[model samples]
Target: MAGELAGHAGDAANHGIDLIPIVALLAAAAIAVPIFKRLGLGSVLGYLAAGLLLGPSGIALIADPSSVLAASELGVVLFLFIIGLEMEPSKLWALRKQIFGLGVIQVGLCGALLTGVGILLGFAPVVAFVFGMGFVLTSTAIVMQILGERGELNSPSGQKMVSVLLLEDLAIVPLLGVVALLAPHEEISLTTRLISVGVAVGAIVLLIFLGRRIMNPFFGILSRAKVREVMTAGALLVVLGAGLLFQLSGLSMAMGAFMAGVLLSTSTFRHQLEADVEPFRGLLLGLFFLAVGMSLDLGIVGENWQIIALSVVAYMLVKAVAIYVIARVLKSDHAEALERAVLMGQGGEFAFVLYTTAVTAGIIDGPTNAIFTATVIVSMVLTPFAIIAMQKLMPKRVQPLDGVELADGLNGSVLMIGFGRFGQIASQSLLGKGHKVSIIDNDVEMIQAAQPFGFKIYYGDGTRLDVLHAAGAGNADLVLVCVNKKGDATKIAQLLRHEFPLVKVMVRSYDRGHAIELREIGVDFELRETFESALQFGAHAIRVMGADEIEIEEMIEGVRVRDRARFEAQVLGGVTAGTGLLLSNAEDQARESGIAPTVKLVAAEEKEERAN
Candidate 1:
């Protein structure tokens, strides 16, 4: 009876102890993330600092960093899955040249250079090769997160980096095989490596088959259930299951999750799955960074600071130079090549995996592994700062506008600013009616691209009064402001309204609020950018829902009339003056009864209120 009582007490104590780490982590993140973000250091560095503080090498709040790191790897797995969601098969095919061509060359070159550096530092060729190859696999999470923060993940340069990361993830399996072969143990045979490779290939094939055949149907059934939690659970199951299959096959779990995501990229549930996985991905990824921070041993660093410091500088310098040269040789411009080099200069999380495997295979002893790991961590810590410094120091390069005409003293009946999609479509009506239109845009690439398509777009900033005058805005009968940015469009509208009041202006409003603002500025005409398309979309939707075509026409007209009335009301009184003019299903039912009177009464009240 006494022993049973003791066991219960011990269990209670253990449960309580578990909550402490949870509280500490949450508290640390709440404090650290905001401060770091405010200071412009970013959230990753914040997590690392928090982890270092909570680690055994510091206050010892978390005893085992290895277990935390192991569990936190799920963050990386989910991160890859989300990345895969964005890469449709078509998009993947489009990036194949960059992935296979640019990626292969960068990794090959960097690996060779880094290995040479290791050998120069007195390491054996095999050991140096392992170290060099490990560093070649840059940190996908850090680079991706930074790219996302800067809104560059889909940019051409960012896409190239992403492609290289994918190739690196794929390289891990073969690298592991290489490590096995180089091990002192005679049992590590070529046959074992071949079996592992075969198993990995079979697993990938199985994942692809299941994803294409089963995922959509499975999601369809869960969606029908209409239980939100169940849909979220289903998403998690798919991610975790794919990861497990790859892990069992001795491949990267992240690669498996990525494969699953790509398979589902074309499915109807793609957006739903991405939304469900996002929250978990964020939390886990943060924890992963924290775990990495905790794993950094001050004892090891203090013992071998000089060697670790020298190695980090040498490795990063060699890797960065190689990447920059390779990128330049492949036709990337100077600025882009420099940015890529800085962003990918650091060794990644995979270095830990490689070094751990090396230790197990008797390739390197514990102390050497510790020193190498420490160097990688330091490099990771230094990367963000390096990028910030580069951004500050690097001079912005102006793109050469070769084969493109500048906005000179040309005159046309209609002056169109910005030759983007909207401006292009808007110009057609004027052109069809035989009005000469002069189009000006600041985008050199867009202007050059439009040239082959017979668009004589000249390089000019519409927001600049001098450029507008040069583009014949002063003499044109009709001035069309069609720039995409709200600020630029507004600035041009204001400029034309003040400088060339004789010319009638038609401006593209970004939204309803922008429409009101534009109207207030007294432009001759203004149209919300998406207003017509959205109305047409709604009309089509109603038609598809079995509404009579005549009734749909009436509804569309009613909406347009109501929108116009609301805009006038809003322009007269404020944005709040047009509430009663909004058309809803409920208003549709009451339209014949008292809706018109109510709208009139609301408009009158708004006028009176504004006057008062």
Candidate 2:
């Protein structure tokens, strides 16, 4: 009895200890992320600093760092999944040259150079090769986050970086096989390696095929069930299931997760799946960085600080030089190439994964892993600063195409500001009716794609007054602000309303609030983009619930007309009404207009008619 009690107490104590690390990690991130963000250092650094403080090297609060690392690795897996979600198969195909050509050259050349250097520095051939392959990868998460935050992900250098990162990610699959083959006790032959590769590839193809077949139906069922929690669970199941299959095949779990994401990218559930997995990805990734900080062996660093420092500096310098030279050789301008090189110079998160795997497989000892891991951490820590400094030194210049004005003998009285999905549909309808439509867009890729479709789209910022004039906006009979951004739409509308009152302005409003804002600004027409679609959907649901089709249609039409009038009245009244006031007004208007009869009044009238 006493022994049982003691065992229970021990279990309780162990659980308590586990909770301490969780609390500490959360608190550290909560404090550090906002503080760093406020200081303009970005959240990646904040997470790293949090990990550093709570790590074993600092206060030594958490004794078992390995467990944290094991848990946090899921972050990297989810990160890859999100990346896969973003990369539609069509987009990937379009970027094939960059992915295959530039990406291949970057990895192959960098790995070869690093391998040569490592061998000269007294490492075994296998070890050097492993290091070369691993160190050549850049941090996709960090670089991508920074570029996306700054809205540069579609910029020239950003596109190049993305291509390289995608290839590097794909390369991780085969690289893992190589790392396994190089392990000391693993005597896997060439035949075995080939077989393993075949199995991995087969597994991936099978997963993607099956996923494409079932994901749509599965999500359809879940969506119809109307349980958001269940839908989220289904998404998690897909990601984790793919990861499991990859792990079983002796491949990277992240690889499988990514494949799953790519497969589901075209599904109707893509947006919801992204939303569901994003929080998990962000939190876990932060924890992964923290685990990295905690895992750093300070003792190894203290003993070999000088050599570690020199190796880090040398590693960054060599990689930067190699990237810059290769980019320039590939026909990129000098400034852009320099920017790309500087941005991607650091050792990646994969270094930790590779080194850890090597240590586990007995290919490299603990001391070697420590030195390399420390170097990777330091390099990653310095990446944001490096990017900032490089940006300051080489500010990104928006180079306008030389002498590329609107094509001769092409004129349209209708001006479409954005040529995205919304604008494209509008332009097509207008064109089909024998009405000429002039389109302007800022996206280079979009402009290029539209040209092949026989659309003469001008590439320029629509918000700029000069660009507007160049596009013949001055003589436009109607200005259609179909841009995705609310601010951009508002700006174009405001510009047209003040500059050319004769020209009718039609703006796409994102939501009710946006429509109100646009109306307040005196735009002639404001179409709430998804409002009609939502109403149609609602009408269908009402019909499904056994309402008469004609009744549903009439009701929907009444509501739509009344709502539009109410919205216009509220806009003109300059009153920011709450939901309660809005509902009250809607009720009063419905009763006064006789659009909807009161239940009590209807019942009383029926009773009186029966009596008569």
Model 1 alpha-carbon miss at residue 561, Å? 15
Stretches of model 2 off by over 4 angstroms after superposition: 1-17, 184-186, 395-481, 484-612
lDDT of 2 by residue, 328-355 (tens): 9989998878878887888887777788
The candidate that wins on lDDT is 1
lDDT of each: 0.86, 0.77
Q: What is the TM-score of each candidate against the true structure?
A: 0.70, 0.67
Best by TM-score: 1
Pick out the ten consecutive residues of candidate 1 with the lowest summed lDDT. Answer: 596-605
Question: In candidate 1, which residue pairs clash?
Answer: none
